[model samples]
Target: MHTPKADYPLSEIRRFLEPGPIVLVGSAWKGRRNVMAMGWHMMLGFSPALFACYIWEGNHSYEMLRRSRECTINLPTVSMMDQVAGIGNCSGRSLDKFETFGLSTSAGGHVDAPLIDDCPANFECRLVDERQIPEYGLFIWEVVKAHVRPDPELPTTMHYLGRGEFMTSGAIVSRRDEFRPGNL
Candidate 1:
């Protein structure tokens, strides 16, 4: 039997539509460095590794990213959820999130941005296009360098469900042999 459904408001659709993982964006400009928790991002392509993220004009990191033209996407594990929520609640313009959250960072290989040492994976990216900023506040980037932990297994990551709620990544089902060599 089919279950009855109730219509939800348009504003609530994001809770159902957003599927990307939450990430900490690390940016630096003119000797200032900041890390902001972000969830509005998606992968655009595989070749050359493209990513697109929306940064509202009001965000402090927005100006830094615009000026530096680079950033590092840091993937935090579920254990760091408290810090993630804390970072999102505060503004980087007023307080240094790195110092507040006690996060350690190292210089990125290809970009001036700093990578959070606590994250298992860090992607260093440079802005490739900014034409959509005025209209959509979108910034497209090309990943220039990537760093990952030596472990073969991945740690649990979280996804925001809006209203201070988040869902942690669950079980994985592998079908590696189902795909042809060139198809992937």
Candidate 2:
């Protein structure tokens, strides 16, 4: 009934517990725009559409996001693996990522950041809290506007496995009948 376990390093913990898909973050400031791949974000609430993410200070987009106070979070599907890896491996300070990766973009309704035209979903966010930035490199944002591609409602998403690896989304399972009514 039980399997034996062995010691594991804490640094590799994210390889097992990484949350959510790798998203491309779009940010614009002072007439400049850039897109960077991000994997450290998570949803915090539903009512106001709150979410949180960590962006290191060394990242070029960090200052842009801090100053602009807005950005677009774009979700890519499994087919976009090349673009995802390329975007994350390169720096925005050198070249136009959208052009380099052959990605296209469009303007969002509520933010100055550009939304990836290729993504199935995009969220325009506004920074709601800056308290954690200096100490934690964390940003709290409220998604002000959201857009979705109507077709293919359930697109397979990619998750980071760390050490240059990934795990793709798989089949769905439902237990609605087994859940408490209030919990739903």
Candidate 3:
């Protein structure tokens, strides 16, 4: 039997996804961590090193992150499009996502979290403060240590919006080489 699939305009979807190319954030509690595909995250500060990620309290990853007060922000490249979608679709409570999805991870030292393998970059963080808004349960954490892959030719970041939508970052085709005169 053949059935027609509902379709929506691509422009409408792009309108909702405001930000672009966001790093994926993951958290763990006792070797059981969940990956949250998010677009609502940003760097708060530099010296003190603070980062904020907005997540719904009801989400499995949010609860785990809140309780543990730590997370590993893993930045995946364009190649991991499928893996990102897989993690986002399922919940850790029902499935051992890492094992089922064939995702690999390493134990973090400073934070009791698992570092997502195959990601281009990863940051180990600890929760500094949390602001709860009924609108969207938001959490802010501080980055403690960062890990970069040995390979330097990795692609730019990848991000996901609501639904099963995602987009990989494009290259900086045109940009000023330097801002300061002697910076180069």
Candidates in order have lDDT scores of 0.80, 0.82, 0.67
Ranking by TM-score: 2, 1, 3
Comparing 1 and 3 on TM-score, the stronger one: 1
The count of backbone overlaps in candidate 3 is 0
Decreasing lDDT order of the candidates? 2, 1, 3
Candidate 2 wrongly placed segments (more than 4 Å): 1-19
**How do the predictions measure up, each by TM-score?**
0.85, 0.88, 0.77
Off by over 4 Å in 1: 1-19, 175-183
Lowest summed lDDT over 10 consecutive residues: which window, candidate 2? Answer: 1-10
Write candidate 1's Cα lDDT for 12-33 as tens digits: 2222223478999999999999
Model 3: what TM-score?
Answer: 0.77
Global Cα lDDT for candidate 2: 0.82
Pull out the clashing pairs in model 1.
none
Best by lDDT: 2
Runs in model 3 deviating more than 4 A are: 1-20, 133-135, 161-163, 173-184
> After best superposition, candidate 1 residue 102: deviation in angstroms?
0.3
lDDT score at residue 15, model 1, on the 0-100 scale: 25
* Residue-by-residue lDDT tens digits, candidate 3, 9-105: 3222221122345556777787677776666876666546677778877678877888898998777677777877777667787877788778788
